[model samples]
Target: MKAISYSRYGGPEVLEFGERPDPKVGPDKVLVQVRAAAVNPVDWKAQAGYLDTIFDTVFPVIPGWDVSGVIVQPGVSVTEFSVGDEVMGYVREDVLCHGTFAEYVAAPVRTLARKPRNLGFEESAALPLAGLTAYQALHRALHLRSGDTLLVHAASGAVGSMAVQIARHLGARVIGASRDEGQDRVRELGAEPVPYGDGFTARVRELAPRGVDAALDTVGGQVLKDSAALLAPDGRLASIADGEVIALGGRYYWVRPDTDDLTALAGLVEGGALTVRVAASFPLERAADAQRANMEGGLHGKVVVTVDHDH
Candidate 1:
């Protein structure tokens, strides 16, 4: 099948569009006909070897994790889904290869979830990783509850925007930190917008003088520190961007593929409590461009790569 891959760790220049061997289905997996895939910063980072120490890279690696597609065939042991099922997943395996940027992917059942009935493939593709990251951080890590006040750093980002909506849906009053250009977006996502950079802590404190009940740091570094200090004594803190969050007495989270969590996010989308914005899109052959677009930053939503199966 035709796909985007790189034989060595490098920048977008190393990515090539060509035919790769089709994946074999495992007993616990299904073959999905790719419809769309979303580009995350991690995709480019991993391709650049930033995550070399963490994951073993197989040469000619296919680089994508978020997918929205249809099941063409299920594994012999599969029963949770069958042929023709529309699904979305954060299809990260233990190793780097056989990813979603191809015409098809052999996805493990544990990573699959029914796509939100209300969204298109591109939008659905955008949800799994970013949505799951926000959901797990707010619900599991932070234990956010109704009436609590929450602070979100980098609130206009892919994960941060999702966090704002999920926190608000959980009934928390949200204060979001972003740049001046992103302030309106943060407000639209149901958070009171606060500017980043100097005095970020002061801005948040102005919104919640007693300190927030919890804080989610998606920007890391000084933002993580500020988030920890802004907590209301026992306030919860978690960061997806920085591992130093652990040293600051907070959990540093890395998103995982969980069917249940993805399904819950789907429910939120169908219920109109969550929405995905597609900032840009490219065809499958141009996936390198998609990665570059995501890396360029300043996007309020996701960069997606669409697969054309009609041919």
Candidate 2:
């Protein structure tokens, strides 16, 4: 069994591709033959040691989280799936489950959901982390409804792409804030685009007039504080990355891996209501290169690592 592992937190150089022992599944878990996995900002953040306090990672970490794979072995206690079933899910953030960067990963039955019928393995790999965060922020945290007005920042990246489409599906009139170059693609996703910069909030206000009902802020630090002033009394502001602004009269929300939510997300995709765009794919051994491209900040979708490329 081959996989990538890091003995310590550092740069992309820390990730090493080679052989490791295969994982065994517990009675309540299933072993997946990983097809593809998503490279998220947290992958790099974790590699750089930012999640040390949050994850309490033991040394020699496996960095990936979101994955789309086939069930090679089903636990005796798990009856929902069997060998050869396609599924997708993220391992819990709190757990030390060897991540999707490996040839096989074992996850609890509760975290695995059948992949969407309309999505390919690579597309399914893009959903669990980024798509779920956007779904939770808008539909769950904002209590979004049809005909409501919503503002979304960074509307062309992984979560932004999902947020724009999901917000529209939830019936909110979405205004997307993005770089001028990304404005066209943002509008194509069915959300109006506002250029991100110094007067970005004012631009959003101009479009909404009465102010927005909610905001999904993916960019934090100054970006979080900047988006806060755009909120009205009923407005909700949630950050999947940062939670510090939750006390400033806006709510902070975090996305945790849940099979229940995965089921609902699968429903949306199956019904043609939700979709994830995959921008890049790399072999498992080149995961560090995939991580580099993601951190470089030009791609509009998830950069996936294909474990079984021949498949």
Candidate 2 regions with alpha-carbon error over 4 angstroms:
309-311
Candidate 1 lDDT tens digits, 202-224: 87888888888998988888788
Which residue pairs collide, candidate 1? none
Q: TM-score of every model?
A: 0.98, 0.95
lDDT of 2: 0.84
The residue-level lDDT of candidate 1 at 215 comes to: 89
Off by over 4 Å in 1: none
Per-residue lDDT, model 2, residue 192, is: 93
lDDT of 2 by residue, 1-311 (tens): 78989988788988999887788788999999999988988888877887677677766677788889999999889998999999999776474437779888887777779999899999999899887888887867878889888888889888888889888887889999889988988998999999988887788888987778888888888778767878777777877656777776676887877788888889988888876788889999999999999989888777999987464
Residue 51 alpha-carbon offset, candidate 2, angstroms: 1.3
